[model samples]
Target chain A: MKFLAEYRDPELAKQYLQEIKNTVTQPWSIMEVCGGQTHSLVKNGIIDMLPKEVTMIHGPGCPVCVTPLHLIDKAIHLALQENVILCSFGDMLRVPGSSKNLLEAKAEGGDVRILYSPLEAVQIAEANPSKEVVFFAVGFETTAPANALSVINAYRKGLKNYSILASHVLVPPAIECVMEDVDSHIDGFLAAGHVCTIMGNFEYYPLVEKYKVPIVVTGFEPLDVLQGILMVVRQLEAHKAEVENQYARIVKEEGNLEAQKMIFEVFEITDRLWRGMEIIPMSGYQVKEKYADFDATKKFKIEIEEAEENPECIAGEIMKGIKKPIECPEFGKKCKPTNPLGAPMVSSEGACAAYFHYSGLVEEY
Target chain B: MASKTKPVKMQLQCPMPKLDFDVITLGHGSGGVLTNKLLDSGVFDLLSNEVLDERHDGAFIEMNGKLAFSTDSFLVSPIFFPGGNIGELAVNGTVNDLAMCGAIPKYLSLSFIIEEGLKMTEFWEILTSIKFACEKAGVQVVTGDTKVVEKGKGDKIFINTSGIGTIHPKANINKNNIKIGDKIIVSGNIASHGMAIMSVREGLEFDSEIISDTTNLNTTIINLIEQFGANIHLLTDPTRGGVATVLKEIAMATEIGIDIFQKYLPIETQVDSACELLGLDPLYVANEGLFISFVEASIADDYLKYLQSDANGANAKLIGSVVNEHPKQVIMESAIGGKRVVSMLPGEQLPRIC
Candidate 1:
């Protein structure tokens, strides 16, 4: 509890809130480039406590929410096969694919399991030598190294039964997508601290310079988020655009070099489709040729046709900061956590879920 | 301030005696020689009492007044955990259910659906815990049944317990009794049981020694009712869906508003950290030994003082109150200073895909 309790201290959070209140001069829309940050802001009631001048826009940083529907369908397809056992992170099991989610598939006797790590899937393959084990590998850069390492470890152990259905997204392209959208009207950004901890803050420099937007690497804790907001507000007040690290305790300038090395060695950048957004170039990772045998899609010869999105879901606009979750017609009516129409409502870190679960009734208080 | 309470380690007295078989086979559940031998080995002697010694197919007991009957089934994997096992959980579950109805639990009927290949030693340990739990709750197991399934058809063991109790004389607990300005009090820390199970679960193992808060709440509730009488309007244990689900269900059922303050909710430090690490909301987690009581506003302070002095309710807190505004909703004022709607848990709280 050492790192957790200190950051959640109310007195310290109050100091940061006061500092942010005094630092801001005008209205500014600053986006947090991680769904985890959005969740923290909404869950801790930070969005309501912040100065009125600052508006925190949610980003498309939830890997589960952004994983393409077709890829999900493919994973489910593999799970339904007679001799395959599909494993995935817990959140992905609830996200809807085309007609059914992985949980639904599981209830229908599909062999679906929720695991914390991909390496565990590798071990499962080792234990059940006869059955093929497919791990639904999905995440941002923070998880890429581990996912990549699983494939490497599988190959080293000569685990032919082990393969990964990966759908990894990156943070920088998402920032660019948001900034490129002229309607987004963003001012600054709170970069995801955990992602930066893996890939480093170096990627944000060019974007900061180009967009003239301050990008502060932020942690998920309440104090870290408040301090990150205050740092961004100070920069916007002074018209300074630079990348700063508010979570320096865990994230360094260069990041974990060995993790990055493992990621690059096993995965190469590729064009990947975001669930509700257009395909951004070099925005995702795919298993390299050397590890292609460990890729589930390739191993199973899967080619799922692109599926259509729910027209009522405005997740793309919400992720781009062009619209708030409440702006959607089905905000909490047709779209709910129980019967979510989009992945945002299902994934724990999703912006829509953060809003729905923690939206404060300003009038009641 | 919420303080971390170490797990209470029960010193089990009786050891497993030597049996002819090391592992239970299909014949053990056949209701013949093997079944009789199995029961005679320990279950008969360990839980022996006047009512259970009758050994009839069903129990016939005398009741003077109104009685409450409740039943529950336990299917928790990893039956053995840090502080307790499924046996105690089964006993406490039925006992608490009956207690919530303002009843003093008396007779319980236990049943088991066990896998064919369970070890005899493990079953004896579970039976010992069950014996200990029944003694602590002041209840007797009058009748029971056992069945066995093949290895793949069942998780090690599943237990179902049903209990009958007499309603307390002064208690008039009802959801309709909930009124505006009523105070809501929790009888201990929250989320410890769920985190304890999560710590030892197969796939997502973390390096924490958190223990389950699985204990009987009958004694605590009976004492509170005896002292406070009709002042206690409602008593509910937050079991499957933590504090939020239980409160939300009450709010929706009675069309009353509930506003709880996050700071006033008591939780252990290690459990809080584990929840944070797993990206889980403690509100949506599960609890076993904790109960939330709705009492009259005037006696809230005195009730909390009395509860805090009890060993089982040492971490009791006045978390919130029934409100007139926002009817049919449960709202929580966060520790920092904002309020949000606390909804029923949609499904199991899954770990985040970060």
Candidate 2:
């Protein structure tokens, strides 16, 4: 509770809110590029408390929300195999694939287990020698180190029965994709703090220079987010675009070097198709050749197929900051958390779910 | 000489049967010697009362004019947790249910669905906890039944308890009685029982130990009912889906809106950290020992003071109030001065405190 309590201090949060109100001279739009930040903003009502000059857009920072439909299909297919034990983070259990979600597969006799860490999946593989255990390794750069280490640990132990269905995504490339979009009018960005904690703030400097947008690496607490907005507003008002660190306590300019080293050694950059957005160049990671034996897609011989996104879902536009969740016609009516039509509605960090969960007075906004 | 030594070694390894049987079998439910031995040595011996000792098929107890009957089944995994276990949970669950109805719980009927391979030592421990809980609640387990399922069919143990209590004549607690100006008072801290269970289940270790806030609320609830009577509009124990879900139910049932203030809601530091780590909202977490009461706004302050005087409701506070606006909705004024709807939980809460 050391860092948590300080960041949630009401008095401190008011100071930041007042600073942001004074800093903003004109209307500016900023996107928080992490689902965790999005949820915190909505749950704590930080979005509504911010000065009307600043509009907060939710980005596709949720790894579970951006995981492609085809990948979910492949995961479900692999989970249903007679001798396979599919392990995934709990959030992915309810994410609907084309035909069925992992939870449905579990109820239908698939050996699916919810694991907190990929290393736990490796342990399960060690315990159940006869069953092939595959972990659904999906997340942004924040989770890359842990997923990479699981494979490294498995190889060190010579765990042949263990593999991971990697859907690892990178934050920088996705940011570039958003900036490159012709219709995008984003003025600043709140970079995910945990992602910066792993990969460091060095990556955001290039994006700031390229897009001329102030990027503040932000934490997930209410005050952290308000303080982050203030930093962005100050930079924007002064007509200066630079990378700032509001979450300096946790994130450093040079992040965990050992973690970066481990990730690079096991993963290679590749073009990954986001669920709603177009494929961004080198926005995803694939298990390196040496670790191919530990990659579930290669081991299981899964055939990748092009799948169609539901036209009714505006998640792509929403992720790019072109549209808000409330703008979608199906937002609260046809689509909801219980019966999610898109990944954003299913993932806990997804912008749609956040809006839906905390949407009463928000309707007026 | 070797045979005699072998017998001695076997005796040393096996040890004495502190219980009649070392492990449970189907014969324990067959109404035979094994069944009698289990009851006589375990259940009846620990939970002995005049009514229970009578050994009748049904309990013939004397009750006043209005009686409240409620039953609940407990199947929480990792049966034993930091503050309590399935046995105490089973007893407290029904007792609280009856208390929510403004009844003073007096007698309970205990039943068990035990797995065949369960150890007698574990069963005895559970029985003992049940006895202690019954004594604390001032209720007696007058009659009971037991069934044995195969190893794979059941978890280690499951308990079902049905409680009967006398309802006070002045008590008129119901959702319909809730008025627009009613105040919502929550007893003690929220989200502790849920976070406690979740921490143990996920093997999460915090700086300080987080124990379940599972306790009997019969006495506290009865005392409040005696003092306030009809002024206490409604009472409910927030169990499966936390305070948010219970509030949603009340809103829908009465067609009134609920507005809760964020700063007033009492939450423990460790439970808050656990919830934050797991990306879970404390509002949606489960509670076992806590109850939320809707009381007349005029006497709400006095009622809160009375609740705070009791050890069980030491941290009690006025969390929210009933409103005519936003009918059938529960909203919270966030600490940051923003308002949002506190929706009911969608589905099962998954473990994610990684």
C-alpha lDDT (0 to 100) for residue B212 of candidate 2: 90
Off by over 4 Å in 2: A303-307, A361-365, B1-20, B30-37, B54-56, B202-208, B351-354
Worst 10 residues of 2 chain B by lDDT: B1-10
Worst ten in a row by lDDT for model 1 chain B: B1-10
* RMSD of each predicted structure: 3.8, 5.3
- CAPRI grade, predicted model 1: acceptable
lDDT of 1 by residue, B172-239 (tens): 99999999999999988899999998877766777787889999989889899999999999999999
lDDT per residue (tens digit) for residues A157-187 in model 2 = 9988999999989999999999999988899
How accurate locally, in lDDT, is each candidate? 0.88, 0.86
Indicate the residue-level lDDT of B51 in model 2.
Answer: 92
For candidate 2, give the docking quality class from DockQ.
Answer: acceptable
Question: Candidate 1's residue-wise lDDT over A1-365, tens digit each?
Answer: 58777887888888999999988889999998898898888878888889899999998998988999999999888988888989889889889989899988988878888778888888888988999999998999999999988988989999889999999999999999889988899999999999999999889999988989999999998899999999999999998999999999999999999999999999999988999888998899999998989988788887777789999898899889899989888978888888888988888788888777776322121
